[model samples]
Target chain A: MAQVILKRIASGDKSAVQDCLKTYGGLIWSLARRMSPNPEEAEDAVQEIFIDIWKNAARFDETQASETTFVAMIARRRLIDRLRKINRQPNVDSLEDVLVEPTNDREQDLQVCVEAREAAAAMKNLRPEQRQILHLSIIQGFSHQEIADALKMPLGTVKTHARRGLIQVREFLGLGSDFEKEATV
Target chain B: MKDLQDNRLVELLADQSFFGLSAEEGMELGQLKKRFPEWENDFSLELTAAAIGLANLDVREDLPANLRAQVYANADEFFSEGATDQEVFNFAPSANKTIVSPPGASVAETTSGFSFWQNLGWAFAAVAGIALAVNIWTTRFEKPSEVVKNPETIQMPKPELTTAQKRDELLASAKDAVQISLTNPKNEKEIVGDMVWSNEKQRGYARFRGLPANDAAKETYQVWIVDETQDSKTPISGGVFDVDGSGEIIVPINAQLAVKKPKAVAITKEKVGGVVVSKQENVVAIAKV
Candidate 1:
């Protein structure tokens, strides 16, 4: 069997570091660049992200999520922490810069690709306003108030759309309804 | 009957997974999970769906070449330090079993040389002491399986060294390594590179120019160290990596086994995440060592 990079890294194989960077550099780099306020901050965040990965390499559970997903989770957690640390709200100008188009790359895992397609399809079932609100809140990293301000909607309406839209997506994916029924019983 | 309360709970769970929750909300989430174990699975699936949706953004961009160099240098320093620590505490017996006599101990106070048999007895005791120490140390701290299961216990503090300093250290260590220039067999002008390998040190670096970056989702570039000394025809794996841009890229060579006599190094395009044994049908470059 091909050696898992994280397993090798946990065993102190120095070369696995290079292999890891080569494998996930683009993903982390793009995430950091998009999330950070500037290129320099993105570069610094990338370094921190790698250090975190090395420290937590052994914790990676292959059965629960793909390596890409695991790494993405770490990257997002660090980026969000940084965002919160700075106490800066998501800029209105940057909202337009967020990439909204979905990719049809065949290289993604079949399961992930299918899930992404389903999520995208399920999103289309939402009202355009709810869909836009969720995209801003989830993908753009905007708070409910910031999204409301950006869209010129009432704060309560923003929260309503975000909550209702997310619940709809979860139901569409066939996840929340069963749990909800079971919980009430 | 799922009512307003149920809808509110679903919303809270979704928000918690997406952007994190406040302390009170987090406590509430814990209570909810404890009350309904099924909610945990539902939460995981929701998070997975959210991640998938985000992955569809296709926001990949090439990192700056200098940043890549810094990352490699930092990793090299970090792992090398770890190896040095392990060697000191875990490998060397003499270091672990230094014999120190108590103050005014009669055995060391006598300067006269002892008989050969007596010296041999002392040596055996020292060896036994080292063995016991090693056993206790390994059992206490170096359990590989435990480390894999709980990485938080082994995480070290980050080093404060600068990137340039780490890169300098890495290059200084590899200064005596041999360098071999690689060429693209099909089109020499299109892909070209060199590999710097130190057989004694069992480490090497590869630098390539003009090799186009691949879509890592579809394919990745795999490195192979062809050691003719090995009985098997299969070359030792040098690990799989991907290029992100058309410029020069420096990659560390990760040989899966000890390379006795490396005859050549080759790079091939393989499926994403790479392969155990490359078919070598799509060889991009080769360096005859």
Candidate 2:
């Protein structure tokens, strides 16, 4: 179905572009959510991704790859682009981390979008911003500027939101042995 | 096991990175790291429990950058004019208006006019045909991917003794002790100690302080490496002796390898110079570490 939509889009059918958006809208939103610092930045990333998909859909070679692969490549490219931008800022690690487990739901959600609903449902403990910040900073790597622009707030406001958000996460971890209580998280 | 680096420890404390570690859990990690010497041996269970206790305070700040659309807006304008370079024909801004198509026109009428339709018809047809033909031409584009015939399962190389590699890997995992703790069956409380690891010898040394004070020695407290690798084997000798005014003794290790990775560290009572394994004077009171 994505293949047909993309082919139609490449064939210059505007409605096919709309159809692609309709079907893949949730997928793109979830990806943006993973990448952005908050819901607002996610909203912006979603818009940017869609506009990019529409404009570049002509280059999509349907026979060369599946539509999911094509869309995923675009999403991953945009995400890595964001990561590179963040990497330009001061970073915490130059070496690769050796941890093996999927420490959070964002990883599971990113690997499988269909699982996001289940993951979100299972996210009983994380507060909204705690989930939002982890999704944005880790997955999206959006800078404070992008977050500020999306949120339409002062730079300090965005920083405060992120700082306060992390405190809540620390609070959750303090309450119990989250590592031992793996089933609950 | 390799020594945990400070930066790696910081990463472990980050929420995105080590979500598995709770704040209280991270506290234990931080506490041990703060107290232990930068490079030392004895990472006992007490240290781990202590690290877990301090886990609750770790926090990370990571965010994104600016996104401006002017560059994109310009690109959109360029592409809408076809893939042709707008920069090339800037002199003919008015001329572009002459070629604009009517809002509504029949398909036949649209193709009826101009040098573009008449002279460029063959070129258009050729491009379209090529576009369509490429699909047919590469009929077998899905040709079987060349398979690399490398062995799927690689056997792990057996560990070879290299004084250099051993020293380095140990340096990565080892830590230095800050204080020493020692106790005996009589003075079972208040044992503080410092530890160090020797990769070349495959052993760790612990120096004791405030240990059981013996007078001319009937018997002294012994340190043993509770060997965990050999089926939770008996506690093996790590040199033992009485402490002087300084309360210091260097113990040679046989199986403190368990401390590098183990359930706990057990202190036992024994004769001087130590024995091969924990005996009748076996494990006095084990430190939970």
Candidate 3:
């Protein structure tokens, strides 16, 4: 039974801050670099991301998601907000490049987190086009239009694939029912 | 129809989670939110993307050493005892320069030292305010004063004192004044300034030699007085001012609320007109009491 870093951070445990930085710094740094338009913005984003992490630490519930998933989720939210504020899109690979490459180049490192492993397994259930669209849009930070243009597909079709792919993943991760229960309540 | 709309809501949420929404889609989502308010906090796609992104993260490059230190420094301040939860923040100080009151001066000596300085506040305010009002009224309604014989006799005007001079006079006179140098904690370039406060007078002033000027349209400098009387998290805002020029400048502290025993004064760059509570991310300079 390991201590939840976020819970400790919420309680103002100084050592937990150190542990959090050590554990999630790389993940967040990578996300920021990929999502922000420039290094300076990335640096600022990281600082603000950590602040958001601390502010939202008390809300971290281990039962809902793994620590890695929770940290990544928080980082994504801030990065997305920053992107919207600046009205700039992330630098993304051309659709052809994404299509030709190995889908899971870092698959070996996927075992580092339970949620990642589960997500990787769940991604296999989507249709090939849906999986590719999700990878381009979600993992590579491409917009729906960008993905549609890159893939030479209709925008509506791209949106459908992305939405269905995410729904499939949500179900695979056993989140759909919980979400439904919460929504109905 | 209900099922189709529910699906549309899910589509919008999933799209928003992935790459945000276009203006039209955002409006649609806002309308749908009214229909399905339960999904307001729903972040399933975001969580899915994060999980998938975690599996795909290629460069888990460690944070730069300098950046790591900054994160720790920020945490120290964010979690500092009695620090308020400010969503907006400024910079930090690399070094603290505290100038305490000179050794063992009695209340009698300090009180005598401030006699001229104490009266100056009242005299200066009354003269300036009344004179300006009179000047404006006379110029607008009546003929201006154009006397020839002894112009100086009609208006016995004292020389206007610059803010720097006022600050200097206060420093020379107030024996209990605490002066602390303010600096940028995270950067190499030094932000030169000193914040001075007198516990006896409950007055303070800030002087900066080379602080950068700010755009009032975008942001302004806000002063904060951290004291023992109130929670450190919600330090009294000492009012907002702008640096419209390049050289040395002095600003009078107009603490919107009184502080009894101030432990520190800080200046943060904030949105135009300043914020009621700062997040402190943009704190440019700080002086410890």
lDDT (CA) for every model shown?
0.59, 0.38, 0.65
lDDT tens per residue, model 3, B132-155? 422322222222354344243233
Q: Give the TM-score of candidate 2.
A: 0.25
- How would you encode candidate 1's per-residue C-alpha lDDT over B152-207 as one tens digit per residue? 53333233334344334445765556878889978766549887787755657778
* Better candidate number, 1 or 3, judged by DockQ: 3
Across B1-289, the per-residue lDDT of candidate 2 in tens digits comes to: 1234433433333322312344565676567457544412221111221122112111111111111111122122223344244322211211121222123312112122334432343344344442232222122112224112322111121223233443344446545421223344456574565444543333444555555565434555565554343334443334444555654444433331113333345565655434333444455535433
Chain A superposition TM-score per model:
0.68, 0.49, 0.85
Candidate 2 interface RMSD after superposing interface residues: 24.3
Ranking by DockQ: 3, 1, 2
The i-RMS of every model, in angstroms, reads: 17.6, 24.3, 18.5
Displacement of the residue B163 alpha carbon in candidate 1, Å: 16
Worst 10 residues of 2 chain B by lDDT: B57-66
lDDT for B65 (candidate 3): 44
Candidate 3 has a DockQ of: 0.17
The candidates' DockQ values read 0.10, 0.02, 0.17
Per-residue C-alpha lDDT of model 1 across residues A99-143, encoded as one tens digit per residue: 232223432442233445555667778897877777656555556
Answer with 2 or 3, whichever has the higher DockQ.
Answer: 3
* Total clashes for model 1: 0
